[model samples]
Target: MSKLKVAVIGCGSIAKHRHLPEYAQNKQVEIVAVCDIVEERVNEFATKYDAIAYTSYEELLANQDIDIVSVCTPNYLHASISVAALKAGKHVLCEKPMATSKEEAEEMIREAEAAGKKLMIAHNQRFVPAHQKARELIEKGELGKLYSFRSAFGHGGPERWSVDGKDSWFFRKEEAFIGAMGDLGVHKTDLLRYILGEEFVEVGAFVETSSKKNADVDDSAVCVLKTENGIIGTLAASWSYVAKEDNSTIIYGEKATLRLLDDPINSLVIQYIDGAVVKYELGGIQTNDIGGQSSSQVIDKFVHAIIQNEESPVSGSEGLKSLQVVLSALESNETKRIVTI
Candidate 1:
């Protein structure tokens, strides 16, 4: 069987760190083209991948040989690029916070449906081994009835990971939509839904651009969420964790507490009320942190979905639902009241 022809729409840090390498590793994919607004970046990635380069996504999508497109552009451009790719008869793997608004995300999904092509969101946290294991344990009722939880994702800000350093699109509200919430909080929202198998129906938040100087977007945000089944919890996304990346979650239950990616050594720690503790040495969540070492399974799953003609693990609708959570959080912050999904 001929390998699927893949084209990446943005040659940014995420495309470099996760999408490009993983797709390169996939024997079933042939990276045929790369696109970026910057000529230098597009040319560089094209040379590295032995693919064609384009400064415009429209030009790249015009290639009839392309079978799949990864929309790795800014948060605001996600819907437009994915919609264009889907209309051009190519499957799409879009990065998370699928779009700036629910309506736009729905439009992307509608376009993918109309084109009869697969659309997957790159919510890589759900693909982490420790998170997968946590989902399994929860589904098996190992933690008993869930009561409350706290999930947070933070780093030293986009200056470190973004290709353009501090000048990246991440800090601009016009391009990023909603700062830390879109970048980090949505990952937690999606993970919580996957782990608990429930939707966040309501949220109250205190989103702000507290720390980072002269930034239009948020440096820190803390949201309190209530699930449909009465599960209450806190979700925090910050770009001010200069000390270290803190991608951690703690789930409390009747019998035990599950700590995910909390400790430096143990990726998962489960402590019981009866003085028993369980620890797993799973690798850290892929936070793009220097010390964090883990590869994503997102590319593999996306390829399999295309091959099998099945919906992706993080389908467009599912991704939109997660995006709605972030939107609701933003609304909650503005209104200073709980917003219902």
Candidate 2:
């Protein structure tokens, strides 16, 4: 079969690090177009990839040969761009925190359904080797009856991470929607749901803008979740961490406790009730960028979905499940009561 022709919209950090590089690596894909509001970024990416560059996404979407589109723009643009791509008959892989609100996410889903195209959200953590292994174990009943789990994701801030740091859209509520909760918390929320194979039923949360600098959005957030299976746990995320720690979950089950940390590499520690401790040192999963390994995995999966005619690892509906957790957390924080998820 011929290679799938793909186009990328929004030549931002994620496009540079994850989607572009991964698509370039995939023998089944040929990136035929790149777009960004910033002409310079689009030009550089298109030049590097040997693809056509456009300043407007509309121009790129007009390419009838493009089989897939990756929307790497900010949180707010996800729905509009994805809907357009789907309507244009191209599969879409959108970045996580799928939309600023549930309504937008629903619209994107509807568009994809109407267009008979795939719409995936980039919740790449689902593809990490350690996380994947843990999920398999849990599904196979290796963890026995699950009890609870805790997870967190945070960094110094997005200033250094983004091309525009403090001035980045991540620091602006209008662009980012919800700060730490949507940025870091949503990933953990999705990870927990994926690993535990349970839906969150309720949430109690505390969101605060503790740091005075860049006070437009939340700096930190902590939430308690109760799963449908009655498993309960805590999730914490922050841009306030002085140093970086990609600390993740500790799932307690009847048979054992499972732990995951992604800093050095993806590592899993499983402790059984009989005092047998098993540690699995799964190295970094292949990603588009080193720091964004999960993003790379997400792109690879999306490409594979296109090639194999299968469902994406993180479909739009699955993305909504994670987003619902974040939304519930926001409501919980505001109302000072447990919010149904």
Candidate 3:
């Protein structure tokens, strides 16, 4: 069995920290090509990884040897690039906020299905160790009958970590299509869906741009969400956490309250109603503060899915569902009404 050849479509921060390095670590993969509009960035990656460099993604996609495409471009380009890659007979592993619109997300899924290629969205929160452990315990009914939860992912802002700093496309609506909600909020939305095995049915939100100056998009957003099973809670995404990054979730249930990624020493803690407590130092959740972790498990799952012809763990459909929740939150913020998913 020959190694699968991969071409990364964008050489941005995500490509540098997560997709590129993680794919290189996969023994079954070969980093065949890298592309970015910036020649210097692409050339740097190509030199580092021993792959061909291209300033145009289309030209890179034209390479017949590439079996996989990692779409690490901005939010606005996710749908188009993934669709093109699937049409070109390549499996796609796209970054989060898979598309800026619900319609776009559906089209990407449709194209992947038409091409019979796997389409995965990089919602890595579901792959975190503490998150995986929490899901397992929830499935086993340890956190019986989940009632409510609060999940937040906030940091100093993308400018601190993005390759272009303050000039990064993340703060530009034309490229990002959203700010903190799409960048950070979507992760928590997807994780809640995965951990609780439920879908968010309704949302009412307050999305604002109060924190970051001169940015047209929201830097802070707070959403009240209700799941299909009647569980309700708050989801927050902010670029205003000037001191430290807070990527934490607290789940309330009839049996026990699960605290995930909240404590510095213990990644997961279970506090029972009867006063019994349990703690597990699973591992730290990936953060921009540390330039992310070495392995998110997302790349590995995507590789295995393609090799074994199995459905992706974070499939296009799953991505669309999560995108819908965020879209609903945006709509709710504007309409001042609870939006139903």
TM for every model, in the order presented, reads 0.98, 0.95, 0.99
- Considering every candidate listed, which one attains the maximal TM-score? 3
Please list all clashing residue pairs in model 3, or write none if there are none: none
lDDT of each: 0.91, 0.85, 0.93
The candidate maximizing lDDT is 3
State, as a TM-score between 0 and 1, how close model 2 is to the true structure.
0.95
Question: TM-score of model 1 relative to the true fold?
Answer: 0.98
Comparing 1 with 3 on TM-score, the higher-scoring candidate is 3
Count of clashing residue pairs in every prediction: 0, 2, 0
The ten-residue window of minimal lDDT in model 1 covers 286-295
Name the regions of candidate 3 deviating beyond 4 angstroms: none
Q: Order the candidates by TM-score, highest first — what do you get?
A: 3, 1, 2
Per residue, candidate 2 scores C-alpha lDDT tens digits across 118-209 of 89988877877898899999999998999988887776767757777677998888888889899889988998999888899999999998
Task: Spell out the clash pairs found in candidate 1.
Answer: none
